[model samples]
Target chain A: MKRTLRKARLLLGVTYAEMMEYRAELYLWALSGIMPFILMGLWAKAAGETPMGMPPVDFVRYFLAVFVVRQMTMVWVVWDFEYDVVNGQLSPRLLHPLNPVWRYVASHVGERFSRIPFVTALMGIFFLLYPKAWWVPAPGTLALAILAMLVAFIMRFVMQYAFAMLAFWTERANAIEDLWFTLYLFLSGYIAPLEMFPPAVREATLYTPFPYLVYVPAKLLAGQPVPALTTGFLVTLAWGLVFLALQQVLWRTGLRRYSAMGA
Target chain B: MHGEHYVPEPMPSLNGSRYAVAWRRFWLSSLAAEAEYRLNFILATTNSLLALAGSIFGLHLFFRTGYRLGGWSWEEALLVMGVFTLLDGFASALLNPNLNRIVSHIRDGTMDFILLKPMDSQFWVSARHFSLWGVPNVLFGLITLGYAGKKLGFGWTEWAQGSLPVALAVLILYSLWFALAATSVWFVKIYNVTFVLRSFLEAGRFPISAFPQPSRFFFTFILPVAFLTTVPAESMLGRTGAGNVAWAGVTAILLLLLSRWFWRFSLRFYTSASS
Candidate 1:
């Protein structure tokens, strides 16, 4: 266990240094997530003109929370993995003592660390622009929200990594992810809050994994009520486990096909 | 000793006809190159359709609450969405595939060869390649416009009126994208800077007036996103005054000129790779 911990530490430290070298690019990536803020403006304006069950300020806060959650939970494993698989770069990594997936995880963790200052700076600018939306959550609620955010990040990472497994068979695996992202964009509360969704649509969307990715944690972070917190956590874990099992199966079978390519 | 008296020949002038021929060759070659990816075309079409459906569904949520966004009716807002999709298609087809390569050119020193060419560097870089993937979005946008226009009782005259602003919107968008992409001359590693502009342009999916006062100001003056889709939609609906269309024309011209000037200024800072 101690040796494994040491290895992880070394991997993360090296990757973190690599990520820090591209500080300006990382900041631009952070800035590219301003879609939530733009939507916040539209939602807030609409909510003011009508009774949308939440006030305009709540919409602002909700989307700010969404921006934070999105930044923390973003995953692009499919793009990287597809490039590696297609370029035969994975051949070298296969000989490593640890699973190659750990390398991706280490890099993602490193990027998240490098991105913290930029995200904080963006949040500061947001509050400076609209200070009326600022509020602190209770300590208990903050703790629960942090835990939910972490789970949401892990769940998203594992799910995309499973999708990345398809690169073993096809060169266009990222296209599939792009199609899935279209659905995620709409159903994941990236465009609007769940409360604004029609009753029937909201009920139906809750059954999908999309809402748990953004809505659950974002609501908690905004200090809004999440109808069934425990159930949300359970569903998230269930989906994560399903993907984890699928990834393992795909990895074993894919390695055979991968070697047939003379890698 | 003879090399000292060598007079450099005057280069051929780049007239309009020459530019037309060059653009045709550029697009034809790119299309031939892209024709190999049959599966990508199908996938791109499906992605565009799904994205359009989702956008309509999201817009429907607001109108279902008996609340109009920025006082725009459902059909009126659909016009805005249609315009936004059309511009997005144009970007994918031309601006994205071409301007996105500016960073790589600067990085790998291929830009040196580009500069050594006889033709205009800006024109060559901006019009070198086109992708076929965005054709579906263009068709879908036109279909949506027709459906919405029919519902709103729009005639050909209305369409003609709207075409001017729509064309200007394209010019404005191309200028914004090219200016952002040219920043690679200084910040070579910031390939995703155009993505920041793209996220800001997402606001064009809705009417500019739909945002709050401060946001509306920012979109209007800072980004000029108001001229992109909202003005065109309003012109189509006959809700905009002549003044607004005139202002949009002025903005488009000014922005286009500004982008050209900015490109020239940034080239002074372009120290070629390995120099």
Candidate 2:
């Protein structure tokens, strides 16, 4: 276990060093992540007139929390996986004893580590900018919220992994990524709350795990508790398991098709 | 990492013959390149349509609840939102989309390719990306404005009188794009800057008046977002008078000239990786 942990540490250092070499390039995407902050500003102002549900103050806290959770939970593994899988890059990973998923998650987690400081500073700004709305929650709530957020990130990344593997079955996997991105933009509480959505649409989301990925954690962080984390975390665990299984299924089916086709 | 940029002194806006030639060359080839990948073009267009639908969906939902937002009735606010879309289309269509890839150039040290050519580097970079796919949104936005205006009870005469200012609003919008795009020199991570600017653009969809009085004040003078979509919509609706139209034109021209100067100024700070 110590050796594995050390190996993980070494991997993260190497990845961060490699990425930092093109720091400006990585910043391009980091900059794109500012979209959530922008949306927060617009909606916060609009909702502040008569808050979304709680109060004007509630909208402020909710959006600011959402932004922080968003920055923390973000990952681009699905995108990288699609590109790599379609290009036959996965073959080398399969050859190795190491699980490729751990490596990919390590790289992403390293990137997220670098970004967390920025979001922490942003939370400070959020508090300074809206003193009345945003505040520190109780220690227990904060702990639960953090755990839910971690579960949410796990849920999101796994779903992304499964969806991205669809590249094996189809060409132009980037298109699939784009489709999922659009869904996340609206459905995952990135744009608006699940509660704000139309009834049927919100109902459909209950079956899907989209809310656990962002909305639930943001809701928790915002002091709302949101359908309660006890249920949410268990559901997130279920979704993650399902996604892991689906990825294996898809890979098996695709590899069989590939071999039969004499590729 | 040697050849990156050449600072040629600006020639007066281009004498007639060469200017006409470049203008003609720009469109003819851009369409050809875009046409080469029909499916990708179709998919890209579809993607843009989805983005457009997202914005429109918000507006539809807002009005579905009530008639007015920020004191402007649904028709008025919707018109402003359409103008926001149109101006956004123009920016992404021309300036922002084109000039934005400079970071890619800087990182790869490939900007030298453009610098090697006799054409001006700034001009070449500014006119680089031509996504004709953005054109439909402009047309669609205008159609939306037309529909909304009819619902709100406005006519062509109102638009004609407002066109002069709406034209100015176009220039201002373009200048803002150019100004921010040039900041690739300092920030080098220009994409995030563009996103932040876009958030302000989103703010312009609703009436400036809808914001708190302080934000309304800041939006007009400090950010000038009010002029981006709202002022144009107001004029084009024939709701505003000549003074506002004149102001839009002056602001546009001033901003345009300012952005060009800043682009030149930023060029001085740019030390390409190749260099």
Candidate 3:
């Protein structure tokens, strides 16, 4: 375990340097997370005085927290994995001792590390522009929020990796990803806070994995009373394990088929 | 082979019948190629419908709380979304496929084939591919617009006034896309700039009044998304005057000219990777 950890650390350092080479693209990718900020404007205006149980200040704080979390959590691994599988790029990694998933994990985490400084700078600008919109949560809530976000990140990665494995069977993995994205857009506090969703829709989504990926973490960070945070954490962990199992099955079957085809 | 390729054919000009025939052949071939993947076509149509449904749901959520989206009624918001969908469909069908093509052509040095041709390089690169798949999105947008128009009780007179501004907005949009894609001649690695442009355009999914006052000015003049989507919807609703339509027409002409100048200037700097 210690050896694996050391190898992972070295791999992460290399990926971080490579990502720094394309710093401009990375910044532009981060700028794409501005959907939350754009929606914040309309929502704040609509919530003129405490509509949907959230005041305008709370709405601002929630969305700003959401902006920070989304930048950290988003992974483009599905596209990368699909392209590699189709192009036979996975053959080289299969020859190595380390699992290819670990390399992907390293690169993703490395990117997250590289983006922290930029996100912090953007946060500084945000606070400078809207002084009253900023909120500093209490220590306990902040700790919980961090834990939830870490779990959320892992859950999302595993789920997306499983989705990408479908490329082994068909060429339309991206179309499937697009469908998933449409669902995530509505259910994950993207269009609006989950609280703003109609009662039936909110209740239905709580049973799914979508809210835990974004809304739960953002709400906890904003110091809102997440009455189901305990349940949410457990459910998120369970979904991660489920997706991890699915990925293992699909990878094994796919490797068998790929080798049979001499690819 | 080289001599034959270099010989100029006896054609009238770039806009001759031969070129039109070639264009028709390309579209027909593209249609046949895309037809082979039936499931994929269905999936594409379903995906666009899902997106349309998502936007409608967003409008529902906003109005269910009994709060106006910046003083616009539910139908007005739907109209704005309809206009956005219409223009966005046209962009996906026509503009987006060429964006990735031009970026890759420059990066991989495949642009030499295009530059060597006798036709205008800009025109050839931009019109080589069309996504017939985006037809469903255009149809859905029209359906939404029709539904909203019925609710608002729009008359033919209103439609006539709306057509002028909408036409000008289309001109400005095409020029804006041209300028963005032309920038790739210098900034070769910015393949995903279209996604950035898409984000900018997404703001047009709602009315300009939904934004704050300062952002209203920014969207109207600086980025011009308000002019692209919202102005036409307001024109249809009879809320805009003739003067606003005239201003939009002027902006369209100026932007079109600027884009032409920028494209020519950028072409001079493009050093083909193959040579």
Best by TM-score: 1
Ranking by DockQ: 1, 3, 2
Clash pairs (backbone) in predicted model 2: B1-B274, B98-B129
lDDT of each residue in B1-275, candidate 3, tens digit only:
68856966576555777678667766777788777878877888888898899889887887888888877899988888988888888888878877557778888888889899877777777777788667888888889988998899988987787788778877888888888888888878765566776787788898999887777788889988888878899999999888888889999999999988998898898888755
Error of 3 at A72 (Å): 0.6
Candidate 1's TM-score reads: 0.95
lDDT for model 2 comes to: 0.71
Q: What is the lDDT of residue B20 in candidate 3?
A: 83
List candidate 2 stretches off by more than 4 Å: A17-53, A82-96, A166-172, A228-246, A249-263, B1-17, B60-67, B186-193, B270-273
DockQ of each: 0.78, 0.26, 0.61
- After superposition of all CA atoms, the RMSD between model 3 and the true structure is 2.6
Model 1, range B104-210, lDDT digits (tens) per residue?
Answer: 99999899898998678999999999999888889889988898999999999999989999999999999999999999898887764788898889999999989
**What is the per-residue lDDT of model 3 for residues A41-158, given as tens digits with 9 covering 90 to 100?**
8888878733667888788888888998898798778888888878888888889998888888888998998899899999999899999987789999999899888987888889
lDDT of 1 at B45: 94
Ranking by TM-score: 1, 3, 2
Candidate 1 docking DockQ:
0.78
- Give the higher-TM-score candidate: 1 or 3: 1
- A26-75 per-residue lDDT for model 2 (tens digits): 55555556545545555556666544554555655666777778778877
